[model samples]
Target: MTLSVALGPDTQESTQTGTVTSTDVLTAPDIPWNLVIWNDPVNLMSYVAYVFRSYFGYSEAKANKLMLEVHKKGRSIVAHGSKEQVEQHAVAMHGYGLWATVEKATGGGDGSGSGKGKGKRG
Candidate 1:
């Protein structure tokens, strides 16, 4: 069964009346959080890539890609994990003299979700 409400012309909202049967609860793009790294002028592009490789264990190509992203986009996502883990990564980045922060991901999620780690250098 379903119930619906219309607030505008030819528009409607619907509520389903039934038990869920194991359908996916959320879409892929709605991850809940991320750790975003901002870029600065102090770190060399090569050094930044090296950091990605050494700290995050990213492959040379992947590290370079993320480093390039940090260079071009001024930020990048380095790792993904629980909030606690990402927070630790952020603090670690700080310890490494990198700029880093954790934030809610760009889209909404079901509250139980993953987050990415962030790192930056200037």
Candidate 2:
């Protein structure tokens, strides 16, 4: 009796027929996560911006930008890094009485649904 095997178009089979390696098996690391602060009834916008400036050391313009993103879009990514980093940011934001959470950043781009709003107290 005889047996035969055929490899796919992209594969070359050795006569010895050892294991095959797939290029697709390897992938880049997961995208870094982010700590997102959402606009909420409980926190003031000025406080949120101040927290960004004080804790994250963001410039006034940058802090105001992120704060505006949160207010208008309903949410904005306040920090980015590994899960531990994001969690730390979230905790610190919470300490400041802001609503924050960690989430995986969308693939290769900022995810949709962030709104736009001018800076205003609360």
Candidate 3:
């Protein structure tokens, strides 16, 4: 008895196969995530706005608007992306002395649909 096998485009086949079944790997798409900046007593309002501007490349008006939201709402979703992306942003925010976190986006949309935008200087 002799056996032969063939590989075809990410699949395997056997010449003496009893059952040739192909299983397609269904990979889940990357879920959307949110980078939330929380209100903190230590950081000044201006500093937060500055971070938004310098780091996120947000316009002065937009930065101030988001900063105001963080101040009043106690928290604001500043950026949206994949989980890893948002996590990196969170770490960067921490380095800037800003309170930040990452959360799975609601409804899989770009966060809460409020203050929905992302800007990177680079």
What RMSD does each model have against the real structure? 15.6, 20.2, 20.2
Query: Residues 15-97, candidate 1, lDDT per residue (tens digit)?
Result: 12122123244344333335566789998888878777788766787778777767776777665444666688899888877
lDDT of each: 0.55, 0.59, 0.62
TM-score of each: 0.60, 0.62, 0.65
Top lDDT prediction, candidate number? 3
Lowest-scoring 10 consecutive residues by lDDT in candidate 3?
A: 5-14
Report the C-alpha lDDT of model 3 over 75-118, residue by residue, as the tens digit.
77777656777799899999999999887654443333222223
Residue 48 CA displacement from its true place in model 2, Å = 0.8
Measured with C-alpha atoms, the lDDT of residue 25 in candidate 2 is: 34
Q: Which prediction has more favorable TM-score, 1 or 3?
A: 3
After superposing candidate 2, which stretches have Cα over 4 Å from the reference? 1-30, 107-122
Name the better of 1 and 2 by TM-score: 2
lDDT of 2 at 63: 84
Question: How far in Å is the alpha carbon of 31 misplaced in model 2?
Answer: 3.1
Clashing pairs in 2: 72-115, 72-116, 73-114, 73-115
Encode model 2's per-residue lDDT on 1-122: one tens digit a residue: 11111111111111122222232332333234657777787688888899988888777887887788778767776666556767888888888889888866443343331211112111
